[model samples]
Target: MSSMLKASVQIDARGARFGALITAIVFSVALVTQSPALIMWQAAVFAIGAFRGPQFTPYAVIFRSVVKPRLKSNPIFEDVRPPKFAQAVGLVFTIIALIGSLLGSSVVFSVAVAAALAAAFLNFAFNYCLGCQFYLLGVRLVSPRNSKITLEVK
Candidate 1:
């Protein structure tokens, strides 16, 4: 990991989970309605999260301002990279969904949105972060010399 990655911020896992729930809900609505606008909205959120950092993501901001203040539980901290990676994954799927919607390919659109929704639902419902797993797998494969990358990132 680079120094920036080393210094990368941590996130409140509770807030992240809450964000996942919101993401799932949004995607669900989009999937049901087949709304390109909704997919674009989510795509924007994912882009911001992936590029600017997860804290700046729309739902994360909502959680920080509206939800976190009401919660009495202690904050569960985790490295931000995994969630950031997750956002990038979401962005990819949303883009694909948007493309499919624009091109009138129901199969592609549904599959893309559904995949993203499933990932978000998994994160929200079971705390099974598929993107985080992929990120870990990537680190393990790409940085075999730094086997501690996972530990360090976490």
Candidate 2:
């Protein structure tokens, strides 16, 4: 791993789930109200999480400073890269949704936001990080050649 990846901070998995839950809820509200502003706000939140890491995102910050401390159980810390990558993916979708909304294409906007919302819902409800899995698959595909790894046996 590169120093930059290694240097990434550790974050509580619970906090991450909390952030995802908050995102899902926000997206749900935005969809119901057909609020472009709310979608833009979500995009901003995802951008912050992608660029500054989860610790600096509003939901994570609130979870860390407020909810985590009040919890009775200890937090489980995990590598931050996966969630960061996920947030980047979310940012892309949200930006698409925002642009679509601004352009007055309800179909485009709804599709993009709905996809992101589904991913967030999965993460929140099942602790399944679709973005994280994609990140891992991407790393495996892009990594340097290996001697033994193969899809078929000779």
Candidate 3:
């Protein structure tokens, strides 16, 4: 029963893509406008996603309630854990970017935001999740016996 319940709560791949698109747009706007507040907001969103899970994230919620319903086909689902871990990674980057902006360090701020933007772009454009890959790698390193480290849609 527990296993069945777990299988039923799979993460939606389309929703993840929507999240990546939203994140990329936010980061791009922040970079272009040099708006620290935007970066901070993005950081907060990522933090919420990481701590509370993606379903509660603003972009994910929008995707679930607004976007998913409009789609003609069924959404694909994957393990929820990897994307949650990925959100944590995004939070770390955005925090660093926010700190750099607050410190008035343009170099640090640019580099951090650029790196984050690149990752987000990869996810949005190519459907490649750098943070999710990192999570999987960490899981594999720490628990070689666990076969669930790979991020495959079930």
- The C-alpha RMSD in Å for every predicted model, in order, reads 6.6, 3.7, 7.2
Name the regions of candidate 3 deviating beyond 4 angstroms.
Answer: 1-8, 136-154
Q: Judged by TM-score relative to the true structure, which candidate is superior, 2 or 3?
A: 2
List TM-score per model, in order. 0.83, 0.83, 0.80
Q: Residue 102 deviation, candidate 1, in Å?
A: 1.4
**Whole-model lDDT values for every prediction:** 0.89, 0.88, 0.83
Ranking by lDDT: 1, 2, 3
Q: Judging by TM-score, tell me the better candidate of 1 and 3.
A: 1
1-154 in candidate 1: lDDT tens per residue? Answer: 4876579688888877898899999999998998999999999999998998878887988998999999999999998877888889999999999999889998999999999999999998999876657877777788747557888889
Per-residue CA lDDT of model 2 for 1-154, tens digit only, reads 5987568578888998999999999999988888889999988999999998977899988997889889998888888877888899999999999889889999988899899999999988998877657876877889986656574554
Model 1 weakest lDDT span, ten residues long:
139-148
How many residue pairs clash in model 1? 0
Best by lDDT: 1
Global CA lDDT of candidate 2, please?
0.88
Q: Could you tell me the lDDT of residue 107 within candidate 2?
A: 91
**Distance from true position, residue 77, model 1, in Å?**
1.1
